[model samples]
Target: MKFGLSLLFIIGFVAIHLLSRRMKFVRMVPRSRFLSIVGGISVAYVFLHLLPELGEYQEHLYGDIGNAFWSFLEHHIYLISMLGLAFFYGLEKIVKHSKRKNSKKTKSSTGIFWLHIGSFTIYNSIIGYLMIREEFSGAWGMFFFFVAMGVHFITNDKGLWEIHKEDYEKYGRWLLAVSIIAGWGIGAISEVNELIISFLVAFISGGIILNVMKEELPEERESSFTAFFIGLFTYSILLLLL
Candidate 1:
């Protein structure tokens, strides 16, 4: 029960992020993807872990307190990630400090985004394999977390990282911090079966291709029969092994 809910939370999260630009409220999510990732994890815990335990009669009381707790965790994670990001920011300052006026300015591009995707895919495939063991709910939980993190990282493109570029070197690490914590929290609270979890994960992952089409290769990306077959084939391989 816990696992399925957590997986769905992740699916919803990735779905929202991947498809956000098309939605009417795309610009009005009221929070950044960073907050959503953190909030999704924290919120799911409240719903799955604490909500049911509260019983239906006293629902309002528990939910309110749980929400407060969720907020606390979200803020804490944000602060912690900020500190980690700050470290990277400091490092960026150092790197730029040694630069001379003769140094060429670099531009960020889709290649950086692709790097994130590549890393996320390979990493998730491995983690999924490791976590799919028999009689290991904890392992499965971790898998959900990793899947969420992987999807977030792979799908992430917009952010201060891209906006500020050299101005915020810690952006990548901040993203890493957010993705990692959210994934871990979701996994820790997850309680479901392997097949269901995998399917939901695959559903979320399919959105990555969607993201690529919408953001990365909006025009150049093709989706003909051949491309469809390739995508289907690749997804089958991943679902089978992982």
Candidate 2:
């Protein structure tokens, strides 16, 4: 039953990447309330759910690692989380720099496009793998994960579309879609050490926070605070109940 449900969720995720371009309402000039709300929900999930889960994973790490240096590091999952945020921030800086350098160009350079797509492909793959392998309380846990991530993908797709334009529609989306399935396939066949999963959970928590914030915080985005609050509080309540 879990396997079947996971397959359904994987399909949902792939659909988000494939069809997000058609979501015209999310591409508004004032930064669609929908997107802002999605940003809020993504942030809420990271803080309320994923971060707490990371703490549990940290406890597991305490028993697993023995080296003094490794022991010290294992306790600081937030450090790994910070690294994830920094990694994506660096990627964003590179993409922005490339855009500024090629001001006359309508789309990001081909190299920059691939760099962006490659990084996100890996990101999507991690999400997919975790869907199968991560410890969830029940089907509801998986459902919430799907909802938060599904909306988060909408925001991500909008950003990529703004940067890469047609290239994203033509190629980048398909790669991401395929990457998720690839990750799920790997998760189904192989179980890695729990230490690695802990690291991944921490890393992804930070990535999600950074990605959502980058979309919402920019001055030109004209993001809707009301909608953001709505999504944040609404999702927070649901998570708490769960």
Candidate 3:
């Protein structure tokens, strides 16, 4: 049953990527407004669902929490969360650094292009892996996860395309699309401990928060408050009802 459901999602995931790349609707929407809505929905998921879910798992993973190893492990999860955010931010910094260092000598930096592709490949793989592992109770839960993540993946694809342009078109998107399937395959076959799964989810929560904010909060982006609030409230309500 799990495999069947996952296969459906994998198909959906691939279709979404293809559509987001080619669809005029995605391009027609104001970039900032669309991103604002997506980002707001992402934030709602993190705060309303993801973090609370992680908290529920904490007791199971940490046990009494008085033991040194338990304490250390708990700390490690939080640290990993922060590290996920920092890692992505550092990747951006590195790309910018490369761009600056090579700007005068060349119009395009090959090093920066590859770096961007490599980083996003890992990011997409992580997202795809997590998709297979996401625990949901029923059709509604699965649907919710699918919608939230489908939109999130579109945002990530656009972000990469904007940054890498020709490189993303030539190499990045296809690799990323394949990585999603690969991740799902790996996740289906793998048996990870619950504690490890908890930590991975926590880390992803942080990365999602950071990535959404990076898109929505930039001054130049000019995000739409109304659109953002609508997405926030709508998803928040669904989560509450669920």
Off by over 4 Å in 1: 1-152, 155-164, 186-210, 220-231, 237-242
Residue-level lDDT tens digits of model 2 in 69-179: 777767798899999999999999999999999999989899999999999999999999998998888999999999999999988988998999999989999999999
Candidate number with the higher TM-score (1 or 2): 2
Give all candidate RMSDs, comma-separated.
15.1, 1.0, 2.8
Tell me each candidate's TM-score: 0.28, 0.97, 0.87
- TM-score of candidate 3 relative to the true fold: 0.87
After TM-score superposition, what is the CA distance of residue 192 in candidate 2 from its true location, in Å?
1.4
lDDT of each: 0.37, 0.91, 0.75
- Candidate with maximal lDDT: 2
Ordering by TM-score: 2, 3, 1
For model 3, how many clashes? 0
**Model 2 error, position 237 (Å):** 0.2
lDDT of 3 by residue, 98-213 (tens): 76777664323777778777776666666677777778767677777777877888888887776666777787778878877887888888967777678777777878888887
> What's the number of clashes in each of the models?
4, 0, 0
Error of 3 at 80 (Å): 2.0
Regions of model 2 farther than 4 Å from truth: none
Q: Superposing every Cα of model 1 onto the true structure, what RMSD results?
A: 15.1
RMSD of 2: 1.0
Locate the minimum summed-lDDT window of 10 residues in model 2. Answer: 66-75
Clash pairs for candidate 1? 2-191, 3-191, 3-192, 145-183
